[model samples]
Target: MSRRLALVIFPDFQLLDVAGPIAVFEIAERYRPGSYDLTVEAVEGGQIPSSSGVCLAARPLSQGPLHTVMVSGGDGTRDVEGLQGIVRWLRTVEVQRPTSVCSGAYLLAEAGLLDGRRATTHWSRTDDFARRYPRVKLDADRIFIRDDDVWTSAGITAGIDLALALVEDDLGAEVARMVAQALVVHQRRPGGQSQFSALIDLGGRTGRFGPLMDWARANLALPLTVEQLADQAAMSPRNFARAFVVETSTTPAKAVERLRLEAARAAVENGFDPIDRIAEAVGFGDPERMRRAFLRAFGLPPQALRRSARS
Candidate 1:
């Protein structure tokens, strides 16, 4: 009678949404192979196709003492036909084995499972979830949210963070740390941090000044000053700044920081570059400025982010 973890897979499944948590859980199981059971269960009883054309099969929605049942989210999950099955199954949880995951928050919202509960979904879906499920306390800016038995996350990659949190709850923080280390990831990843605190939450194509955002994301390393941006848009600094806030729900400077931080994150994730070099390359003067900015925006330092990226 091993503790079992089930992941609900469906068509248009975000492949990473399915893979990230599975990878972390499998990596954790590797430490003591054969200790726990892990299975990918299709919510609607079929070999479901993912957005990438991969087919995933599963056991029929089970009604057992499942320690953890994960709901993955993606473009395919827009409708509730497949997810009603999961919500119905969860209605039977005996002790609630600390279930959670990213993008899965949408389905929970649909089931009325998140009413009055704090939760997070992918930033892109935050507005839609808010519009659809007003009773659910939604925070698009957070990576993951935990309220008693139910847990949710912002997007696909945060699934790893959710998995790490579950491991921490089950085996203790030390084991979770070991699991994260084994997976080359950080265990204590902050749930409050947004998926891309500094990246464009929009499609980068909204507002009259949307072109500026698109340009900024592409050239984050450049000295993107108010003057430069206003010049590009052929508007005065005062006029453009005002219009920007109205259109994007954030200021231009803040948007630039998001882009810069996103760039820094990519650099940290891909290679072993010095913090100073990374800071400079990402448009900061040095590690100190980047550290403060990263801390302010992401609640983590450049080094910590680099370590997490490496992990």
Candidate 2:
């Protein structure tokens, strides 16, 4: 049986958000001819301009059963929440599964589809998304999330990751691999893989503890006690802990652990160093401790991450 795949786009929608997933399903169809019948659509139906100025012609929102419906995200989604017609159409759509790429989760959230659901979006929008939609469980670190029949992915290229996962779920791993290979993607990153490590944003920290976070990231191998960090930030330990949580949205120990985990995972995946050596170098002290940290952050042990990276 052929499944109908509908991609919903709006004015100023992110181009790749629509193109990437379409390419994945299109490629998958080559492997299994007629596997999918694809359509690009919009609420009004016409040529819609993307954020990049490229235009995509789309059909008007049609009434029917769709195997899957995906919504694209961009600056336009901010306005989607206020469009009564579009919002009403989204609320009324009947589909076996609904999905969103990047900030498209905003539209789904606005339509009440993501209430009490686990979803994710562009990492930079995590705070705003959480603030606006407190009903949604937003995991900023994930590459993508699938709760029941709904799927949501992080920003930009992560849409490709989500499509590859869908292809895997429908046609099997072999077909998904072929699609990924044709797309020239390195590998199908697991959904559990983090979008990015928090350490990378330390330089952009705006709080009074900005320099302290930079120092902490650089000195991940050190003990990095709260007192030490407080001294670095020129504040009392109690005040520092309180303020740090308010500014960074995480505890000092957790921040340090994330830094260490990021560093250890890089070494494990990209270098020839043994697990114990990597652990010690990253302040994990022992392989067991690093293994536990890896499990907590990535849902995979160090060895498993290493093997996946190599494979």
Candidate 3:
């Protein structure tokens, strides 16, 4: 039986939020015939202009049975008053799986569907999302998250990852893998994987710690204790720790660990080094400790990641 899935959109919605998932489901259907019936929907239907100025033709919001209903996110979500209709519709929709991509989680939250549910959205919107929907457990560090029947993903590209996961859930891993290969993307990134690269903003809000971050990366083999980092930054340990968090939005210890992970992962995936050697070079000191860290942060062990990377 084909599962009916709808991609809900609004005016000024992000284009990829809809397109990425469309591509995933379309590819899956090709691999497993009659696996899915996909539709693009809007509150009033017709042509909806995306944030990038491109427009997509959509059908009127349907009251018919659907297996999954996914809402796309973009600048349109900022207009809270403009989306009341969607909020109301979402509240009454009887889809088996209610899902969202990026800021679309905002609508689900607005409709009260995500209340007390573990969800995720774009990393940049986490602060505002948490403030607006305190009842929703927002995990800022994820590509996507599923709480029972509700699924939410982070950012535009993460939508592809979310759809690939749904394909796997419905059509098995082989079909999903073939779809991913056809799409030229990873077979599937675990929902627990961090969405953003920590290196992108290691310097913090003002780039005040840029030099320190670079130095830490270059010296990942050394123990990057707070005191050692503080000395390098020319500040007392206590004052440095306090200021680091205030500036970076992360503790010094966490920042160091992220830097090490970034370096270690690169070596693990791109080189033929032993896991123990890679772990030691990245300051993890022990192979088992690095494996645990990899599992916690990536939902996969070092060995599994290595094999996936090579495959």
Highest-lDDT candidate: 3
Judge candidate 3 against the unseen true structure and give its global Cα lDDT, from 0 to 1.
Answer: 0.89
Task: Please identify which of the two predictions, 1 or 2, would achieve the higher TM-score against the true structure.
Answer: 2
Report the number of backbone clashes for model 1: 5
lDDT of 3 at 211: 94
Alpha carbon lDDT of each predicted model:
0.74, 0.85, 0.89
lDDT of 1 at 175: 73
Candidate 1: C-alpha lDDT? 0.74
lDDT string, candidate 2, 88-124, tens digits: 7778888888999999998888889999999999876
Q: Candidate 1, clashing residue pairs? A: 121-154, 122-154, 184-311, 185-311, 198-258
| TM of each candidate vs. truth | 0.74, 0.85, 0.93
lDDT tens per residue, model 3, 118-165: 999987788899999999999987889999989999999999999999
Better of 1 and 2 by lDDT: 2
Residue pairs in steric clash, candidate 3? none
Order of quality (lDDT): 3, 2, 1
Q: Which one is best on TM-score? A: 3
For residues 215-288, what per-residue lDDT tens digits would candidate 1 score against the true structure?
87777678999999999889999998887765654577877887787788778767788888888887886789
lDDT of 2 at 86: 62
